[model samples]
Target: MTLLAFLLGLALGIGFWLWQRQRLQRQLKQMLGVLQTDASSTAMSVVSRLRQEIAQANEHRSQLEERLQTWRRLLEVAPLGYLQVDEENRLLCCNDQARHLLQIDRWEPRQLRLLLELVRSYELDQLIEQTRHQQKPTIQEWVFHPPCLDGEAMGEVRSLTLRASSWPLPHGHVGVFLENRQPLIELAQSRNQWFSDLAHELRTPLTSIRLVAEALQGRLENPARRWVEQLLHETNRLINLIQNWLELSNLEKNPSKSLTYQSLELRSLIQSAWQTLEPLAQQKQMCLAYVGPDTLWIRADEARLTQVFLNLFDNSIKHSHRQGTIRVEVTAREAQVLDSEGTVDSPPFSNASDQPDSDASPSLIQIDMIDTGSGFADSDLPHVFKRLYRGDPSRQKSQGTSEPFTLVGSSGSGLGLSIIQQIIQAHGGTVQARNHPETGGAWLQIKLPDHKNLS
Candidate 1:
């Protein structure tokens, strides 16, 4: 009975053991399947996210390219030339206008080569270098001779005046804009030449007419005599105008050639000019008062210097009110200090002498001639020095008054101030017009380089 009981327990125990083993194996298989499914899904999710990101990156790249193409199209059609150079100064990109202006035939887009190798322009190279060095916008103008596209010598072609504005870009790159100003330059030069020729041609005929008018001056009586005198007067006036035009033209053509340098006392010159115009001043009850060092010396052309003050005084006498006082103030200033004020690009006059030289005298004789007359109109100040520019009516009669200026020559030839400017520039100096602050009148300021000064 004991043996039978033991066998029964063993059987039960073995059966339980076998069942437990199967259960454990099924659980292990279930967990392994769950892990495999999770790992596969995670991997697939990561790959899908990567693919979406790649697609977005491609779309962005395409958008950027489209925008770049649009900008290039706009720049291509622009009138002014535009070009870019890399940090190495290698020609990067340029528009059609730039190609033509620079005569760049051997290059195309995406090609990089030294700018010096592509275009032979020292001025252009210098401008690029300056922009890079200063890291600021810079402007320069130079005469550029384009290379012969037909393989002929470049020297055979006419040059163009090119103005370039350069600005630095990121990473040492530079962009430049170019303008072709040759046409404007040519037009101005031609106009000046035509006027100069016409002035020359009229000189001979005018002298003959003056001679005939003078010959008839002695043979008329009463109204006829007055008419003849008037004819002579008008003829003289025309002759004067012609002479002045010729003089101004000559001065412009060769300013230095028109001068004869001489040392003279500045005070004496002003006094002489005042004396010459004293009769005219007397008619208007005007007085000349000079305030400065009594004696000052400068090197200048005597005749031209005399003409400057004569015109200034004549202008004052013509416009000054009754009992007006014309004041002359003189002072000496250093060239460096005065030059700091800068100069105009299109000043009243232009000449090589107008540029200051290191060897030039450090002294400048500044003369301020102020008159108690109607000052220049705000609109006419800039154009006053232009030849034959009409004067303001207020110049003939002061404002807030009814009296007319009757002392002077006929409404003036309009060449007076123009001649004055030429004379000043020819002496390596400057002249300007403005309303005097203290005098409340037309102010003429002139500076002449002085070889010697008191202070």
Candidate 2:
């Protein structure tokens, strides 16, 4: 009986231990399932948030691109040349007009670098230096006189007026603006020249009549004759001046009414001008010489050009010291080689099309009038060609010192240069006055388009 009880207790104890073990195993699997579900939920939440952030970032990028595109279009299509360069002189962007001006193609960020390297002119280099160092806007004028096709022709002459500025951008970029100046130059030339020439024509006749009347007053004692003669002379002068004014107005009103344009030898014109003024030159005892090429010719109006030389020679004679020498020199400028091995063909400014050796290119004819006389004061240089502008107010007063043979007669009504400027401009030319670089006297240079061989 005791052995049987022991066996049964052992069996029961073993069965209880096995059942507890299976229950523990089942509980452990349930715990594992709960942990896996939590992990999956957390991962899904993170992925969804990430996707939303990426979509927002893409939206922002699209908005930025649209804004950038709008700005780029405005920059590219603007009529004025637009450029953006960095402090390092690197071009970031340039408009079509800017490319045309620099004579460049396929504009790239690298092009700005090439331009900086290729642009060797002192004036342009100065502009860049000023912009980078000073951090301020600058204005400058650039005149391009390039040699014609492969240097076998004359290149067209073009002028550019550039206004460049730079300021700190939101993202650190620089901006620049460029404007064309051909029209402005033409307009200023027209307005200034017209007034100047009118003043000159008036002074000429007035001076002649004044001299005659003064002479008649002393020689003709008859009161009625003297009075009538004086009146007639003054009236004629007034009428001549008014008639010239009327003619000028008419020309402006009907611009299509073209004047005669012909090819005339420059040497012959100079000779004629010299002969016309010889008596006056001799009377003043001043030496007037023509130092120009024999074969050079200009396409211009004969009478008008003659008037330009006449005024210039007369002015030199009037202002020169007794026995002073007046020099008229002509120069044919040639294109310079850009690099050591690079050769540009022939000369510039001597032809019409600004291209050398071309059928259409006309050479430029320049006439320089240099006199060893008192030069204009520095302050008066800018206004020298203004109508009715008398040089040195003090000198105008000093006319009280009566001197005979003042043919031009004491600064000669202050219209000489104005008239010269007008006539030269009418012929599609330009004139400038400065102190002669070598002689330190008044130097007046007249440049006109030519059709003759500059070689």
Candidate 3:
């Protein structure tokens, strides 16, 4: 019985050990399955994140392309010509208007070439170079002569005026906007010519009427004579207006053509003008106080300059208060100096100490004429030199109902200031009108380029 019990115990022990070993093996297999599932989930997550990032990147690229195309479309249809060039001065892109203005017949999108090779425009090239070098904006206007092509006549020169405004871009690139100004210029010239022709045609009829009126002046009596006298006065005024308009037309056609320049003592010339207008000045009880070097000289057309002075003095006399003074100050300066200062550069009413140093300058002469009265109406200041611009009725006060300042009266032509401007400009000089800060009245300043002495 003892031996049987021992063998049974050993068998049971061996079975128990085998059962434990199988259980451990099953646990190990389950752990490995769990690990593999976790690894696969992590890998799938990584791939999905990468794909989403790629899609976002593509959307951003499309947006950028859309914006670029939109800008290109807008620029293509713009009225002004737009041109772009790269750092190497190569033509990058241009609109149709640009191509037309520059006369560029060939353009290839895939190829880039120097601007000079496509369009031979020195002015355009220079403007681009200047903007690039300065790294800023620049402007230039020039007449462009397109190259004569295959069968065009060389003698029949064709030209157009072009105004270019350039702006610098990143990396030494430049963009230029071109405007063709020839059409506007031609239109203005045509209008001026039409008016000039009308003025010419009216002259003959006006003269005949004037002759008839003068003949009837002696035969009429009392109130009838007075009516004829008024008619004659109006007729004379019309004739004067016609003559002035014709003269202005001629001056505008070619500003320098009629000028006969000669060096004349400025003081004597001004004195002579004052003498001629002395009667008018005395009538208004106004006097001119000339202050400058007695021997100062200038090269100008004596007759035209006299007209300018006469018109200016006449206007001053008409606007000035009774017993008021018109002060004339002369100074010599470099052209640059005149370019900076204005007509009313002096102190209020002036002081001897504040006078400009009159030491002679080589390039220019400045004349300032200031009157003592109410200055220009604020509304009338800018239009003072414009054609047919009239002053406000309040400012155009006259002596004894003569209405001296009016071009012809409430029905005036208002060409006096315009004539003065043309005469000055024709002599290569500039004139500015302003209310004088010193005298508190109308001020006229003139700057003439010196031509030196000539025989």
Q: List per-prediction Cα lDDT, in the order shown.
A: 0.79, 0.62, 0.80
Model 1, CA-based lDDT: 0.79
**RMSD values, in order shown:** 7.4, 14.0, 5.8
- lDDT tens digits by residue: candidate 1, 1-455: 89999999999999999999999999999999999999999999999999999999999999999999999998899999999998889999999999988888889899989999899999999899989989999999999987676755655778889999999999999999999998999897788789778878887987898788787777766888788788878878877887777788789889988988877877899999899989988887889987766556677788889888887887777776778999887765554665544432223212333434433354666677888877666667777788887655655424533223222223367777788888889888888888766656788788766645322
Please report how far candidate 1 places residue 378 from its true position, in Å. Answer: 0.7
lDDT against true structure, model 3: 0.80
Per-prediction TM-score: 0.69, 0.48, 0.78
For model 2, the local distance difference test gives: 0.62
Misplaced by over 4 Å in model 2 are: 1-137, 140-221, 243-258, 335-362, 393-415, 437-440, 452-455
- Residue 363, candidate 3: alpha-carbon lDDT: 69
User: What stretches of model 1 exceed 4 Å from their correct place?
Assistant: 1-77, 83-160, 165-175, 335-361, 392-398, 402-411, 450-455
- The collision pairs in model 3 are 349-438
Instruction: State candidate 3's TM-score.
Output: 0.78
